[model samples]
Target: MAAKGLILLLFFSGLVSSNVEKTIFLAPEAREIAHDAVLLGRRLPVLTPSNWSLRTKIDAEFPTEGSSQGKVSWFFLDNLTEYQRYEVRICWAATQPTAFTLKTYEPSVAWEQPDLRASIERFVPNSQQQDIRTGVAEPTSDQPRISSALVLQVSAAADYFTKNATLMSNVPLVDVDVVLDPYILNVFPRSLLPNAACIVLVAIGSFFVSRWVIALIDGLLRADAALEKKQQ
Candidate 1:
């Protein structure tokens, strides 16, 4: 019974320990700005990293069709980072080289991590680091020279692209809005309730086994006395 209880405890501990914590950083303003651009029938801001022009805008809040059920977005010319993915877009627009706004999802811990800031600098260097300001103005040009063509494809497959865009760019870098911290911490200590419940179950099972063993021993002793009395 003791061995059984120990085994059960170890098993539950392993299961709980296997839970991993993951972190990701994201600029919600990018998505918000993209949504507004799509709603107002306007082209989103662009940043050209290499010879290929790169543009980003959030198209849908949730992906309707895709293996990854993340928010839908349009990524032109591939600026996919290790943590970022682009969805479908309605049209492609010219790259705009201008100062862009980048607001963090979590302002408290956004700039605290040095590694995240380094990644942003390494991937996109032209963006000026500024305090996160709310209610940023949208870009509007009175004389629009180019028109965006429609994309007839219903949905894109799982494969976005083979290579990362930052590795292949050769053109002058433009200021692209990037969030320094893209990940949030998720602690699994909340799982302790289930672990405690399992431990209680093991205890109850052990109690029953112990009781059965005691009853069996008592019955054997009583039978031995009865047989001795019959022999006498």
Candidate 2:
């Protein structure tokens, strides 16, 4: 029973240790924006890495469909960071291909428009997934301009490419997630050594504890046998 309790305690500890900060958005599958651009609702402001550690995740609040499920959002993310190794993952439930475009920009004070520095585009097929990761290796450069587009089948159906028109979606829901600290930490082997050590220590401790209990039982049995002899 004690061993069963210890196992249950360890299982619960793993669950508690694995929780992450989650922020959800009822992001549009598609929306027309300024300059005939397609965006996934408003800009998302992301905040992170205050102490050189950044972990964020964007995913559907649940597997449900339609707009009624999630919180209505504008500029969905609250902040974004640069000069860090990060990953941007977009997952959806549609069977049609979704055009995922990431546009990067440098803000300008004049309000004319932010300068579009770089644009990354991918046509994700069968609505599988589009994962964008920066710093694939050691020496990595900055990634992304800012906004995103999860254009679901609209471009496939209409002239969204040439018209530069913002459009809506036929599909139900989409989510963007940013949380991946555990994966990033594992990239460096040293980050995992301490956790491995802790597991070994626990196993060793449990073995020693069981041995002590067994020895105590044996000693008590021998003493009872001696007492029986004396009684005889």
Candidate 3:
């Protein structure tokens, strides 16, 4: 009966341990920027004024489709005013026993337009420079024209089942190798190593406990036998 109770306790402990999940955040990459000038190189004759707009699509590396955490954004700078705006969209997923549901988050300010513009100007000042020459005079540089097209920011979360649990139906096992970022993982507590030394310590402790229990039982049995012999 004691052994059976111990086995049941161990089974419940295993079940609890197997349900742990690990979540990580992943940032999205900008594949290509959309704009009229980018499509038709600058060499093309300047035709009518260009009204530039762009769209980008993102997909998870694993599980192809469904809920995941990430952000998509569209960015543009008003060259005349030297101000920038990042229109962002964020989404995330929660997994259930039966299905996964995607939750979309409302877009909010990621960075101030003026601050973004200032940073860009400081890093790439020559980016705004242009070249011109005066007749019979030295050539002079002018501010380079900034592209109307903007690159959007994309961020997402990569989650994995760390515990020993069966995959749900229709859920694809993500096989992509992920190198965990040490900076982020440091925030979470990890399992201690189950080394040989620890195992030996546990075994020795169990052996002593079992011996003590068995000795008590054997003493009781002997007392009962001696009493019966005396009665006879």
Candidate 4:
């Protein structure tokens, strides 16, 4: 269904006219994925001038209805290539009781239930979730990119049949920000020299400031000792 939606989106996007202009979320960092929904959150504080590699964001809507287990959403990190690195982040919104579990593997691998969760689910402030979610999917080794499909499912102790199901079904929207932040390997040293120089200067300044502080404290102690000896 998600694939089908993308097909329709590709064909009809920019072709249709609306009474009011709809908001289009472009993968700003990852322009290769020119079309997609940009979730509310920043991937990193640092900025990149070039498109050496950018994190991919895929917009997905978690189903309000699912098996007794709760709502589930499936997504694929399809916009990947060989010889690349990324920091993938998947973000979702749900209540405290509703625990999210992720299952992912390379498409080439056998379709078996993963023994362990690829990442852990966390519920933080929406403001922080975007950034916190950034760390959810850490870079797996410094190796190049490998494509995979990720399945996120919500589960809780309360049953959907029960009247007081305080999670998943109640709050089904999940923000999957499978963002891939690239490493310095691809970036030219010249491009980074400016920031690197600034960092070096800051470190040197801090070093001198700390030494001066230490000398000041030492002088004060020596003066106090000398005064005490003279008084004696």
* Count of clashes in candidate 2: 23
For model 3, residues 46-107, the per-residue Cα lDDT tens digits are 11112122122222222334424322212221211112222222222233121122221111
Off by over 4 Å in 3: 1-199
Candidate order by TM-score, decreasing, is 4, 2, 1, 3
TM-scores for all candidates: the values are: 0.27, 0.30, 0.24, 0.35
* Global lDDT of model 2: 0.32
Q: For residue 98, what is the lDDT in candidate 1?
A: 20
For 1-232, candidate 1 gives per-residue lDDT tens digits of: 9999999999877654321112223222221123322222222122222222222222212223442332222211112233332222122212321222122222112224464333333322212222221222434554322222111111211213226564223222322222211121222222245787899999999999999999999999999999999999
| Tens digit of per-residue lDDT, candidate 2, span 65-173 | 5422322221122123222233323332233223333222222211233322111122212122423222212212233233332211111111122232322332333
What C-alpha lDDT values do all the predictions have?
0.31, 0.32, 0.31, 0.36
Best by lDDT: 4
State which candidate has the highest TM-score.
4
Which pairs of residues have clashing backbones in candidate 3? 69-156, 69-157, 70-155, 70-156, 71-155, 128-143, 128-144, 129-144, 130-142
Candidate 1: 10-residue stretch with minimal lDDT? 150-159
